[model samples]
Target: MAVEQNSLIENYSIVIVNVAVAVIHYQDQYLLGFRAASQHQGNRYEFVGGKIDAHETATQALIREVSEETGIDIANNIAVKLGRLHHDYGDKRVCLQVYRIEVTAQQYQQYKNLSQGLEGQKLTWVEKQKLLAGDYDLPAANKTILAWLQLPTQISITYPLEHFNNASNPMTVWVQYHQEHLQIGALVYIRIKETGTEESINQLLHLRNDIKAIIPYNFYTEKADNTVINRQIVARHLTQAQLMQCSNGIAKNDIPDFIIASSLPLVVSCHDKESIDAANQLAKACLKHQLAPVIGIFLAPVEYTQTHPDTSPLGWEAWSRLAELADIPVIGLGGLSPVMSDQAMLHGGVAVAGIRQFFK
Candidate 1:
C-alpha cells in the first residue's frame, strides 16, 4: 500500500501538459460547456477542452476537443493561441493551453447546429456582459484564463512625428528591417502631434502611404484629435483631466464603432490602482454608450525604466496583482521590450509594451 501511495505521489509530481482549452467566440458571445455531475468539479461551467495525447500538438488537441465536445470542426488556421495557464489543483498540476477560435460570419452560421457532442454535458453561449457580471460560476483556475482571452498578443508604439521629417525614406527602411527579422503581428501606433504644420501633415500623409504599402496590417495615430489618419484612439488614463482631454473634440457616439465593419480596440493606460479603477468604470460607461470597451490596459513601471529611472516602479509582484483586477487585457509598460514578451505574458500581461524599446 505504501509503494502504491508513493507511485501515485510520483505521478502527481510530474507536470501535466495534456490539457488544452478553447475560447470560442461567435460575435460577442463565448461558448462554454457545463461539466457532468460525475466528473471532477462536477456541474460547474468552463471552457470546452480535453486532455492531449502524446502524439498530438497543442493545436491538434484543441481541434479534437472542439469537435468531440461541441460537434463543431474548426478549419485549420482558424484558432490563434492566446497563452497557457499552469495551475496546481493539489492532486495534480495542469498546463491549460488556451486558444482563441475566430471564425467568419458564414463559417459561424454553418456551425449553428452544433450541439453537446459529449454525453452528460450541455453547451450554452454567454454574452460578454453576462460573463463579466460573474452570473455564471466557473472554476477558480479560469480567472486568469478569462483575463488572457481579452488580451492582445503583441503591440508596438512608434516614435512621435518629431522622429522623422522625411517619413518615406526612414519609415520604409524601418518596415523592411522588421519584416526580415521578426515577423510579429502588432497593432502599430503612429504618434501624431496635436498641432502640426502643413509640411508635417504632408509628411504624415506620406508616412501613412508608406505603411499602407505593407497591406494586411493595422496602424493608428496617438493624438486623439488627429482622427483624419488615426484609425484607432487611445485614452492614456481615466483621470477627469486626461479623460476630458481625450474626449474633447470627439463625440460620444463616434466611439467603439468609429469605423464601420472594423474591430477597432480602445487602448487605455493606467499607472496605479486609482487609474485602474477609473479605467474599469470608464469601460462600463463605454458599454452603456455602446462603444467598444477598453481592450488594452497598460500598467507601467514594472521595472526601473531608462525613461523614468527616478520614479519608483510598482515592481513585478504588485503589477501582477493589479493586472488580475483589470476587466480588460493589460500590458506591462515601462522598462520593458519585445524581448520580455514571454515574461510579461507569464506575469499577467497580455503583451509587453514600451516606448523606447520598439521606437528607439
Candidate 2:
C-alpha cells in the first residue's frame, strides 16, 4: 500500500479533474447513455456517472450522480471498486474513481422504463457481448474499465492440459469443476500447456459462455479461429516471453497475428516491472488498433509454492509494490486462496488465482 503518492500535476502544469464514475449493472446488462453529438466524447456511448464535489466521498458523489442522471435511487445497491484509471488527454488530465454498481431486478426495470436521461441523453441497456464486440463507440480512456468488466473477482485455472490426457475422459474433472464454479458465477481457464494436443483446444472452444476460455499464446496461434469470437472467452494469454517479443512497440514491427484478429480482451502473465512495462506497451498498441487492451495480468508467486521451492515468494509487501507498477488489473497467482482476495485488492491487485484452493 502506498502511504503517499507523489503526483506530477504541479510540475506538468496540467489541471487534474477528479470524477466519480460508475458502471451500473444488472446481470449481464449495463446501463449506458448515447451522448449527444454536441457533448464531449460526442456520439459515443458512456457509463452513467458525474464529477465529484470536494466535500463528497466517491460513493456519495456516485449516489448523487446516479440520482441526478436517472430517477432511480441506488442508495442501497452494492458498488464494488473496480479500481481507478487516470488519463492524460493532453489539454486536461482526469483521474477517474471508477466503481461497479450491481443493481437488482426492479432497479434494472426502473432504468429500462426511463427511455432518456434526465438531461436529454439517450439511455440504453447494452448486453455484455455487444460491449465486448466494441459495438458501441466508447472512449479509448475506458479501455481498462472494459477489462475490469470482463474479469471476475475469482478466477479458476485448470491443471496442465497434458495431465488430463491419460484419463479416459479428459474433461471429466474439468466439467465437474466448471459446473461447480458456474453455479457460483465464477470462471474457469482451461490452460493449454501442451502444443500437439489440438483436441483440447476444440473442447475448450465448445465451452462458449459456460467457461470463459483463456488459452496460451502457442495454442491460440495454432488453433484459434478468430473469424467469429463469442466475446465470452478471453482473447489470448501472453506468456512473459511471448510478451517480450513485442517489447519495442507493436507499431514498426508486425503486431502478433492473434492480437490483430482479436475482438476480445487479452490476459498476460507478468512478474517484475519489466514484464508489466511490456504488457502496458502492448495495451497501448492494442488501444490504437481499436482492439481490446490487456485487461489484466497474473502476477505470480506471492507466496512460497511447492512447484518452485527454490525461488523466493514476493510475500505481501513486495507483491503490492510490484502490483502498483501495473496500471491495469492484477490477479495475484501462486500459493494464494480465495480468502486472500481482499488482501490482494488492498495491496493493488483485483483478485487472486490458483488451482489448489479454487479447485478444492
Which candidate number would show the highest lDDT if scored against the true structure?
Answer: 2
User: How high is each candidate's TM-score?
Assistant: 0.47, 0.69
How would you encode candidate 2's per-residue C-alpha lDDT over 306-347 as one tens digit per residue?
656787898989988887777577889989888998788767
Candidate 1 — worst ten consecutive residues by lDDT sum? 1-10
Model 2 spans > 4 angstroms off: 1-20, 26-34, 49-97, 101-137, 161-186, 204-209, 221-233, 250-254
Alpha carbon RMSD to native, model 2: 5.4
lDDT (10s digit) by residue, model 1, range 96-165: 6666676567767876555564654778778867876677788755655553454455555544444454
lDDT of 2 at 156: 77
RMSD of each: 13.8, 5.4
Report the error of model 1 at residue 69, Å. Answer: 4.7
